[model samples]
Target chain A: MKKSWSHESKEYKIYVVLCLILGLAIAAAGLYALQKLLVPKYMRGVVEGSMIAEYYESEVPHEVLFLGDCEVYENISTVALYRDYGISSYIRGSAQQLTWQSYYLLEDTLRYETPEVVVFNVLALKYGEPQSESYNRMTLDGMRWSRSKWDAINASMTEGEHMADYLFPLLRYHSRWDELRSTDFEYAFSRDRVTVNGYYMRCDISPEGEFPAPMPLADYTLPETSMDYLTRMVELCRENDIELILIKAPTLYPYWYEEWDAQVRAFAQEYNVPYINYINLRDNIGLDMSVDTYDAGLHLNLTGAEKFADYIGQYLVNHYELTDFRDVADVARAWEDDILFYDELRDAQNAELAEYGELRSWGANAIEN
Target chain B: MNKKILSVMMASVMALSIAACASEDEDTAPVVLSGGQTAESAEGSGAQEAGETAAASADAYVFTYNGIEIRMNAPANGIIEALGDGYTYFEAPSCAYEGMDKVYTYNSIVVRSYTMDGEDYIAAVELKDDTVATAEGIRIGSTEDEVRAAYGEDGQPGTAGIEYTLGDSFISFIFENGKVVAITYTAIVG
Candidate 1:
């Protein structure tokens, strides 16, 4: 008689246990592989999604950490800071990164390293509540699992977002299976570095054009939520003995209202934090918007970012005691790698421009979405 | 035997999940058709001259000025041309990338256009003064009751005003002392 499988048999029991373990391992591996395949590669156009994760790969310490929106990420060049002033800095910036998100990111950064100075751009203060989900994902998705990431997700989720979606991004991005491309498979295990210490480079030039008149607003007051986060950021930095410098980058599209600037200035005064509105200091910074801006007057091109970095680096070195990383051998070697990456990115962008008259690989024209 | 069945079932479930995604992949596949071209550039090149007109015919929140139908989310060039050059223009660059957010102010009304992808679409039309009114006859000076009578009570009321959402756009009215102080037709951009 063919003996039926018996739980009483030790051999049979061992086989069953092994089978169960194998099944679980397979299930877990399958899900992980699926996740790797479905998630956006962010290689082509919208590379901002990859910026947050790149911070973990930094082997060198940074003395300056920048936080905020594209105004910080796209407007300032970190490599230029390193090259010119030997000021080691990193930009923990994302597209339209909100104030609370910045606060949470600052918290996350302190977990690993505390920079001497934290520079925060003030333009994101205009947004009071949670904005778009896509923008939120671009800001929050690359963050590694931590208490700060958890809080950031809780604070940043839009109406339709759920905790589970962020927890298993596979669940949120499962529908992206159809959009999978060659790059998705190529980068499934690892992704190419998108930013140079968080600097998004654009070499193409579009002169500043005539902008529309600023629309009158119903309310001029900055949101209490943003103000509270700013206060929390100040307190957090104060606790860590870190200097928080507030700045408004010199971009002339979103119309930095006098009322808004006045409020930020008042907050800075009350908190005794230094505030710089670069719009007022455009000439002093030697910014020529006509040739400097790549997208009309929205953001600075590579040349403009280098100029802004030089100006900010001067202020940083003058005001705060930042490390001259060039003198340190190990740190200098790491930064030299970064400088090479920056140069390569600039060359690639410039090459494309020379061929296509515009950046076909990196700019608005290259956006996959 | 039961243990083997359970393990197989667990493995099968995960396998099914993977298979299901593969099966639905074709339906959701993204098709990249062409390169970027601004609406103005397309119009100038005569490749998409009728595209905005086609979009205009779709159901939209419209603010008609001098019989020229200005539809929300439709290209702004046609309406601007029909409305003539009598209006003042102001433009601001978008936050993310290329393109501009444009505002055209005529004597009585203001038309705002936003950029998506690389094209300019009418984002909002504001009746700045009492001189202009919606096609439904609701003007800046219309009473709240008059607006309610025309738009129905389905409007989402807030501290600022009441907004009636229609498809992808909304008609908002700012009320002061039970009277409509401002009126706007706006597209909802996520």
Candidate 2:
């Protein structure tokens, strides 16, 4: 007669418990693999998503922290800033980063290290609400776990986005199963850094073109929600003893209105903070839009970014008591390594430009789906 | 029984996963337009089908100028041709997305178009001056009371003036000191 397994037997209970534990471990491993394969590897084409996460890998403490959207990230060269004025700076900027996102990013940065100066670009203030799920992922996914990240995600979710999706990106991008490329698998475990201290490089230039006339709005007031967040940003800077400077990057399109400018000016006056509108200082900064901008007038190219860095670095040194890192040994050594990377990147881009006349590897054409 | 319970749990997980990632594509709320006519209300008011397509064709709001039918969410090539080639054109490339947003300016009107799937669709039409008027004869410099009289109370009120939606399009009028300063027809483009 075959013996039936007894439920009360010690061996049976132990075997069942072991099986349960093994099953859970296997399930967790499978989910992790799925997540690694599904999440976007922003290695090429639309590499803006990869910029935020790369901030953690920075070795040296930055005395200046730049916060905003593409304007700061694509328009300022940190390596150039170091080279010109011996200033250590990092831009915590992402694609279309909204106002609240900037505030939260500042909050997150304070957790790791506090910079003496925090320069914020004001273009993102026009957005009152979350803009896109993709943009939210770019700004939030790379942020390390903290209350700041949690609050940022909660504030930035659009109509259909769930906290679970942000928690397990596999939940949001599981539809990307069929769209997986070789980069997804290759970068599943590790990622290549795409920015030089938060500066996205574009070597090829598209000369400035005539922009559309600014359309009149029903109401010119910046969204109240955005303004509130801006107020919070100011208060946060005060608490951290960080000097905050507001800037309007010199992009011709996405037209900055005079009415909006007046409001920001008034706010700056009220707060006793300095506001610099680069549009007015374009000529002084020596930016010839014809050669300086890459993608028409939306952003500056490598040449333009370097000039901007030189100009801003001069301003920063003149105004603040900043440390000239070139005098410091360890910091200088680290910056030397960064300079090498920057030179190599510029050389590679220039080579591609010389070969194709247009960037087939970096700009709009290099976008991988 | 154990196998059955496990099957049920797996099915629930699959269902919950899909529910969590629900698609955000469809926008089916009824659009209310000027003169108190809605896509829903127009059905009872003897509106006829205007296009071959079934969705929103019958009730899509169109702005007419210089004997041309300018429509939101419709191809702008034919309308541009009808209005002639004397337009000041400007193009802005999308930041992270594909395609360019193109603007064409005529004498009294400005037409803006956006590209999707490699095709240009009319995104907005702005009446640049008092020379241009809506089909209901509302133009720049018209009083806010005139707008209330023509569009009735069904229009949505904003900080500037009232906005009326018809299908995938909306007409917004900007008023300052009880007079209309600007008028625009826009499409709710994805």
Candidate 3:
């Protein structure tokens, strides 16, 4: 009887192992199916696509890169920097990139093409309320990149929560995925020969004595992670013999009340990086600081960015002694090639502008040369 | 005797499972159709201009069919039709992650429409050697910097004026006006 019982137990063990193996296999298959359903929404027509399409397909390239929310994407045009002052930079940023997510993206993509300068946009202060609809890309993470690209993906994520964005994307931004796919998504953005000028972020606005005043962050207290990323970015720049510069793009909508300006100001001072908050620079930057809003005063148009880039460009040339690449014929010619995408991009933007005048948001501007 | 019975039962169960899996595999099989893009291309690679659309060769496929370039690319996954002058198309994306070759062929299909037609499509397109347009399609409202802080720097007015090039249909901001009075949208085709 004892031997019989032992044999029965062995039989059960064999059955359990088989069942476990089968379950794992099925789960893996299901996961692959989910990925197939979701990934294409963002990465369609990746091959032989446009120039900017090619840039995003690869890792970050510029020395000091910009990564954050769409505020950066819509606000900053790296090409503007290249054209205005010949600052060879790239926008590694998009809309709604949370501090947690972009920090990892920077870390992930940094190793491939590290930048000496890093620009980040602050958001969590005003819209800390998770339900407060975000005006930018809000993906938590990405997944299933190929073997060679796997390192970039991992580096981008760092220690950030790998959360549902990868495994359960349908839960967070399914509608966004569906809606965005309607347009041409570079699907895979490469950075070769890219003309990117990344910059822009704004403070919220208040009516006359509405909140008493625009209380900017006295001392901007950034997430330890953002600060750490900044530090790492600075160090990386040092290692590469690159100079790091920080700019806080101005906003009509001040995210931080003037009270907190101390924290942000002190932090900028402590880091020894130039902090040009357009709040104070409205007059300084020569911007009217009164009438540049299109979306209930949420963001700026090309008019504002040109002035801002020009201001920053002059500063770089005067103080940093940066070269004006376009002064030479070949350099100007190179810059012209970057505009090859402007037309395609314009078509894409035309669609958005048609949806809502002045409030047209930023998105993929082209699908071709 | 009991051990023998148990082993035989277990073996029988395992056999039944294997048979069930086999049947399931046979139950649901996918059929792949060689849509017009690939098949037509190769066969027509040598055939020149079927109707002036211009095919490289007999096996080449032209992006035609009422001047719509949306669904012809992915004939199977989604459908596209016109909504008045504007047309919209939806399709599964064709993405190649890093070195992977179309591990993902189709999914996340979307439909888009524009108010413009073929002439607009062509006109908007800044072909090689074409001039850019800075002043053609730009309009400006008030120079509300209050709006600038809220929206973004992309559309705010500056000392620089809008720059357009009819030489190539190009548009750039030139900071001529005290504010950004002009902005331009270009083209989409390669």
Candidate 4:
């Protein structure tokens, strides 16, 4: 009877161990589900917020890294670069991304793989400090955990933001419980690609309206803080033997002031880097502002983006000696898939514009709540 | 056998604890007051009075000053259509104020829109010409004392105005030289 009791005890121990394992697995799954439900699914609307995070999903190595605010992401077509120049690229950009944020993003990119050229738009140089928390989250949230992400969060945090909120996003997004939609659950585990190599496509057109005249700034000089980060970006690229090119994309509305352009030009010259102001070359680049722009003059639609990309692609090829990989079967095959996606996205957006009279399924208005 | 029982009990307790925490979150979730009325009032209010008020205000702008049901980030197309087409759209020049891009004016009713992520959303609604009044009959020209009487202790005084918090919304009365210059309703969203 004592021997039977010992055997029974051993069986009980096995049962307890099995139950413990089951309980732990359930607990881990519950937490993961909760985390997924609380996070923003940028699938439906405000897709620019999803662009920065999409970079981590790319398995292919990028030869060029484009960093800037909306002007870079919206203005250049990465698909065009790949299809035409065979130069794979990614744009790490968000709305009003500050210079320091750009620097940190570049740092993060370096941690993954070093690109041959780092193209930074000078438009972000206007702001010396973090602009808004919403914009900051769009840029920072999708970044994988690393020292670079930590520094980016610290550098980009505005007043009232906490490091802990970023560490465990459930704290910040707990309030989203009431605002949850089907997309939240559907995309909890994964997200659809919002950009093709960081290019957001807009097929609709809204011609440029009369922009309010550029008001003279109290101080025309680019902020010292922004200049310091620009210097850091240049130094980082130099250390890594990556060519740093500064370009001001040709968006007419924000009024790239002559004074601001001059400051960027002087900085580029001082650093011995190439500065290309596309604003001056709009005519030469065969851009028709009336038809090319989607939202008045703020950003280029798909048409303008392709044209601009074609121009920039030629320049990148000539200046950087970038290879045309159309001959290479593997690279061409990957690009063909990307082109298919690009065509599908453009067709979908155009169809949406046709059916709805405006993009209903995709912009801010798409959020049901 | 005792040790096995204890382990099983502990696992059960842990699972229940997580469920309890989740339930607590749901229980405390902010109740979205819909259609300018609370759920309790909808069910508990006298049917006759509720029907009468609903029918009377059917065509009128359903302004709820209590709990500030006005939303700032909503598309203004519906609200503008409701307010009728006497409004003119005015674009505030670049750098006028951060985020604020345009204002729609109809008599004394003004709706301001702010640009975020390159799209416009209604940010503020103001009644400045005494053409519109709150559900409580408070208008732009109302005195501080009148506002105090209408809103009672719900409003807390700020530097230049008095703000009343209703749920996730705020109804603010801006006073200049002891007279209310504007009455604004805004809904805050994260």
Which candidate has the top score in lDDT? 1
CA RMSD of all predictions: 5.7, 6.8, 20.6, 10.4
Task: Name the regions of candidate 1 deviating beyond 4 angstroms.
Answer: A1-5, B1-12, B15-63, B68-108, B114-122, B126-190
Off by over 4 Å in 4: A1-25, B1-100, B103-190
Q: Tell me the deviation in Å of residue A167 in model 2.
A: 0.7
Q: Per-residue lDDT tens digits of candidate 4, residues A201-234?
A: 8887877676644432223678899999999999
**What is candidate 3's CAPRI-style docking category based on DockQ?**
incorrect
User: What is candidate 1's CA lDDT for residue A256?
Assistant: 95
Q: Supply every candidate's count of residue pairs whose N, Cα or C atoms clash at under 3 angstroms.
A: 4, 0, 137, 1
DockQ of 3: 0.02
Which pairs of residues clash in candidate 4, taking residues 3 or more apart in a chain or in different chains?
Answer: B67-B166
Rank order by TM-score, top first? 2, 1, 4, 3
lDDT values, one for every candidate: 0.81, 0.81, 0.39, 0.73
Write down the TM-score of every candidate: 0.81, 0.86, 0.45, 0.69
Query: Per-residue lDDT tens digits of candidate 1, residues A188-271?
Result: 999999899998888989898876555444346799999999999999999999999999999877789998999999999999
Candidate 3, residues A1-369: lDDT per residue as tens digits? 453335358776676566656655655555444434433233222211122223344322354466665455545556667766776666655434545445455555554665556666655323321211111112323312334234333333423223333334333333233334432243222222222333332222211211112211212234454455556655655666666665556654434555345645676688676656666676676655344432333455455555666776676667664456666567567557665555345455456566654222322122211
Distance (Å) between predicted and true CA of B116, model 4?
8.8
lDDT of 2: 0.81
Residue-level lDDT for A360 in candidate 3: 21
